[model samples]
Target: MNLQGIAAVVTGGGSGLGAATARELARRGAKVAVLDINAAAAQSVAEAIGGIACVCDITSPESVEAALARASAAHGAARVLMNVAGIGGAKRVVQRDGSAAPLEQFRRIVEVNLVGSYNVLRLAAAAMAKLDPLDDGERGVIVNTASAAAFDGQVGQAAYSASKGGVAAMTLPLARDLAQHGIRVLTIAPGLFLTPLLHELPEEVQRSLGESIPFPKRLGKPEEFAALAAHIAENAALNGEVIRIDGALRLPPR
Candidate 1:
């Protein structure tokens, strides 16, 4: 489980939490592969961390295969996979006009967040399974990104929440499924963080959102999320768990 010189794959590593994780992993001596839908961002981060850059579409099987191949070619088979490539959509099940929400909206969220994550995890785990076991019989570790909304979704968050909830719900079972291969799976359900999307909001809006947290009264930093993920990578006893990094902020029902 030591990250030293191990191959690691980080999807959505262009920016936000994934980018932070990639940097931290590199800092911890892991040779990282930065995969993202944004080729430029991926290249930038990879260049910054001296890692490999892979342009990948997590939703496509062919894309995932090619990306992993490139990653492996550059940095051997990955022993760590961070599934952070996801998208969010906000929509209620019904509208005020007595019309149901478009099913496509719901499907897209689940496809990117849930299905995409599973796709990368499976592929990376397979590669990890083939690696010679490290000390303590550990082959690899997977850290999946969920959201606090999965536990306490507000109004208009049905799609996003459902997608994240599926991630949270699958952690233990997936870990069990992969345990025989010496692979560990865990989920990190983060609270509001200063991701690029949220950082684009007005300063006052950002402050108000940060003030909602119970303590620290500010948005969680991307580096903080990375720190927890880095710790999980090294700690073998932490498996099949969903740890929330929300500053004790249980969202309101809105």
Candidate 2:
């Protein structure tokens, strides 16, 4: 797909990898929509990229539907969808307090990470399928965000890991399902990146996390993740795979 002038929707586009991806897509001539729970942050990024800002809470069906409709009305149906809205929670199934992590907490992680991704995917895919094919019948591409923890989760990451794991496991099936419409699906499993959460950590803790990477020995950059997403979007053959961006580091047990 050329991406030029095509409509693209990026969830969690307010910051981190999603924001970087939105900017990159905009630079590549795509009509981007910045979707985030934070309207202010979404508006900031959208204004910077000359794109639309749609406030959306991925965990809510009504919120997602309205946001998708708004974006589609503004830029037309999305031919590129990026699922990047997620939350990170760390707790063992049985916490040190001799109590298990609340079921609601785990459900919330799954809701925002897994079900949220699916909500956007289904909505975007439906819209994309209605569009005419471009560049050898390729109508669109959907990129999902997972984490390296999905594959190598350490202690105290049950909820986070499970959420990401669901994302990784769904990639192939989604691709297969969407292939008939010339739509591709892919997932990215990033290692330790300097997202807002990670950046807020104490300086020493951040340094320790960076040093844990076997190579590079530093946090991954948001731009790096965005670059890979750009490559995946442009390369039609690359589908149904979870590409890991970890710096050769397998996380240690917490």
Candidate 3:
């Protein structure tokens, strides 16, 4: 899909990977809609890129649907949808308190990371299906964010890992289901990215995390993820696959 003049929606565009992807898409000539629960952050990024910002809470279907409608009104139905909103919650299945982690906590993670992604994809794909196909009969592309933890989850990451794992597992079937409509779906399993979660850590701890990487010994940049996303958006053949951007680092159990 040629990104030039295409309409795109990026969820969680308030900051981090989502923000980077929105900027990159804008740079590529796509009209972007920056959607996030943080209205101020979303508006800031959207204004910077001359795009629209729609306040959206991915976990709420009404919020997501409303945001989609707003985005469509501004940029037309999106041909590219990027699902980058997620939360990282940490807890042992059984805490030091000698109690199992509350089931609500686990369910919340799944609600946002897995179900939220699906919600946006469903809405976006439905809109894309109504559009005329571009090159190679491609109508749209959907990119989802997962994490390397899905494969190498450490201690205190059961909920986070399971949520991301669900995202990874759903890629193929989603691609297949949308294939007839000329829409492609792909997933990215990022490793040790320098997102807000990592950035908030103590400097020494951040360094330790970076050093954990086998090579290049640094946190993955959000722009690097954006680059890959842009490539996937343009490449029709890259579908139903989860590409890891973790510098050859397979995390060990903590």
Best by lDDT: 1
Residue 230's lDDT within candidate 1 is 94
TM-score of 2: 0.97
Clashes of 3: 0
Candidate 3 has its poorest 10 consecutive residues by lDDT at 127-136
Clash pairs, model 2 backbone:
none
For model 1 the TM-score comes to 0.98
Stretches of candidate 1 above 4 Å error? none
What TM-score fits each model?
A: 0.98, 0.97, 0.98
> By the lDDT metric, which is better: model 1 or model 2?
1
CA RMSD per model (angstroms): 0.8, 1.0, 0.8
- lDDT digits (tens) for residues 138-167 of candidate 2: 999999999999988989888899999999
lDDT for predicted candidate 2 compared with the true structure: 0.93
* Number of the candidate with higher lDDT, 2 or 3: 3
Residue by residue across 92-192, what tens digits does model 3's lDDT show?
88989898889999999999999999998998899899999885899999999999999999999999999999999999999999999999999999999
Question: Which pairs clash inside model 3?
Answer: none
Question: lDDT for every model?
Answer: 0.95, 0.93, 0.94
- Model 1 CA lDDT for position 34: 98
Model 2 stretches with alpha carbons more than 4 Å out: none
